[model samples]
Target: MPLDEESPVAQVRKNRSWEYAPFVNYGNGMGGDRSNYHFLSLGVEAGKVLTPTIHAGILSGQFQLAVNVMPFWQAYTPAPHTQTFVFQGVTYDEPVGGGTYTGASLTPVIFRWNFLTHSKRVQPWFQGAGGLIYTSHKFPPDVLVPHGTPGGTSVWNFSPQGGIGVHYFTRPRRSIDLGVNAVHISSASLGDHNPGVNASIQVQVGYTFWK
Candidate 1:
């Protein structure tokens, strides 16, 4: 017998899909420095049909490289200044200076998320993920307590992130997603040994495969 043209099995087979895209991120550190930090990433996702109104999928992405410059210190002050102050049995005037510190991180991991997919060409979503981040530092030599201090140390840290955003599908199988994501890296103290919180707002774009 000839199969019906509008058979449900045919529609189900035709709706299978996948998606991917390269993304760029822009935001600030916990300290609110609007530096131009950027990253390149590739994401792959697979979706399964649950019902006409529902779909679910897992997403994973790898960051090729991520870089940033952050400021640490704002100013420095010395104890009460006196013209006739004696230091090491010698009279001298102590000078005070102010500066900032900077750092960067580069580590990649696979992030997984289960999304409640929407049907509109433009859809909104929310997801949470955790991964490993390798962090590094770059501080001013003069800014350190002692001179001739080395910079650039890498540490392994865990990052947990979550966000909500809208996805715009400009083409049949491609879309641009802009959203705000909060990423937290466990405190890492190195060099001068200062431990602090590091976080950022992430923006990304992605393309769908077999849409």
Candidate 2:
């Protein structure tokens, strides 16, 4: 028996195959305090072609560890020379300090759309994602205070972000992707409080698995 060239079943079978990819990315953070960070990520992506021109998939990546610290200053005054110093209404003018700390644990969930899946050599895609970020900092020695001290603080916070990227397919199952992402993590404090935001760019290489 001969098969019809225009049969819908044959078309469906051709589009139902699987695909996957692996990639790496590098970009700088934007907004809040301007800073830079680099990331290395690897994952498996699988998708079925719903139509000749459309495809979709999910991705998960892990961040080993990273550090970020912003220089900040605060005001303080030494104890009064005498009890009458307070009665005299004395004021201190020296203020300002510095500190450094380390933070880790940041990851993202990704969703992508392939609009040019039908093309043989060149394919373009768009993506969007959101995830949680965990960060903490250690105060400087000079900033530490006694049990009753009321000015020093330590912090931990959560961050959320999203971004877009374009994938250029070099082979039937491989491509290079480049994009940008933005993140926001609320501030944590032991004494004083402030919120912070981070932004970066992503570049990756992806491979597809077919059934």
Candidate 3:
């Protein structure tokens, strides 16, 4: 049968060669940093299916290896100011770094499993990925006692995340993607104090081109 003869959604799942997506994501801190932290990013995703379809029933899917690169990444934080802390009976004044922090990020490895939905319009998937972040200033700012001192965080940090998503094919070789990811940021002791964003719930929307 000719490739064009198949349904649009099937074109994406049946031994497809490549996928390219341009996506935007927004997230808010979920754990300790909830109320004060937010994130927004625009990025591109490129990858190829590395395996033939396998298994059966709910476990059936193809494996793909992809990378996501975000040149425009921003974190909205509390404005730079002094915060008071009391340890024991002593009152301490600490200067904090905040406001908008700009950076770039890259997720070099995304292990994605495209599930076999047996449907004509929707293909759901789950993926696990790890990435790197570089900001202009130390991230998740730490306290500085004397002001102008290093906040003891790092400009570079690691982001490990996982999520589930669906691709809705609007036409042959094209899809609109939606997903929700749980991401964790950590320095792995790359700095003196690693007050990373413990967890964040991110929502993503993208348009994909299939080949």
Candidate 4:
């Protein structure tokens, strides 16, 4: 059946001023390879709607734009994984540690592509966000060896992330969000080392305000 054209969710056209998104991120353990490096993120977003919701392509309400300021808190442990190597015609075994760590980040831009329909209660979105993160301690030496400084990691790292999520609305212009995200942390070659750590799959829950 066709949905009500006048439903608040259907009629929303990016007419709102700002949105607040508060979310939590659960790391997926870097595709199941590493377990000790899994991190959890508590985050929030504030942004201005840049475009009206557009019905285009295979997904309705798929095209939307917003500029956001995002802040996050993250915590993790650095459990070392074992690595075997051949050096000087001999086999060597080593422990590659992830190390215990805590950090925070501030992202300047967050772009969301939302899939919308006439459904007034549910919306789906894909997102990418980038910015800087600061840690209380340097990253694990293993993470910095190949790409970064051999013995130490940087406290200031470049952060990049992507994810998918869905929002369920209980009332007009408000929603509860759930999703997962993957994140990478490194100094991007500017901080002496570039060894990077890939956080495991992240779980997220948040609330959104569309006004």
**Local error of candidate 1 at residue 103 (angstroms):** 9.7
TM-scores across all candidates?
0.47, 0.46, 0.92, 0.76
Candidates 3 and 4: which is better by TM-score? 3
Residue-pair clashes, model 2: 16
State the lDDT of candidate 3 residue by residue for 1-211, as single tens digits: 6654557767766756699999999999986545579999999999998887888888899999999999999999888788788889999887877888899999999999999777787889999999999998888777753656347898999999999999998877888999999999888889988888889999999999988
**Model 1 C-alpha lDDT versus the unseen true structure:** 0.40
Better lDDT candidate (1, 3): 3
lDDT tens string, model 1, 1-211? 2222323222223443334444444444444322222333333333433223233334321111121211221111122222244668887653322133333333233232323333435455565655554433332111222342322222444556776665565545456667677766553544343232356566654444433
Top TM-score prediction, candidate number: 3
Span of ten consecutive residues with least summed lDDT in model 1: 67-76
Model 4 clash tally? 18
Question: Candidate 4, residue 85: CA error in Å?
Answer: 4.7
lDDT of 2 by residue, 117-209 (tens): 333444444555444333243222122234322224434444455555544444444455555655444444433634243444444454433
In model 3, the worst 10-residue window by lDDT is 141-150
Runs off by more than 4 Å, candidate 1: 1-16, 31-119, 135-154, 187-194, 207-211
Q: How many pairs of residues in model 3 come into backbone collision? A: 0
Residue 211: error of model 3 in Å? 1.3
Candidate 4 residue lDDT tens string, 1-211: 3323345455344453466887776664564345555666677877665566566666655444444333555556545566676778999886565556677777776787777565677767888877787777665345335443334567788778788888787666777989777777778776555666666467778888877
In candidate 3 the C-alpha lDDT for residue 144 amounts to 58
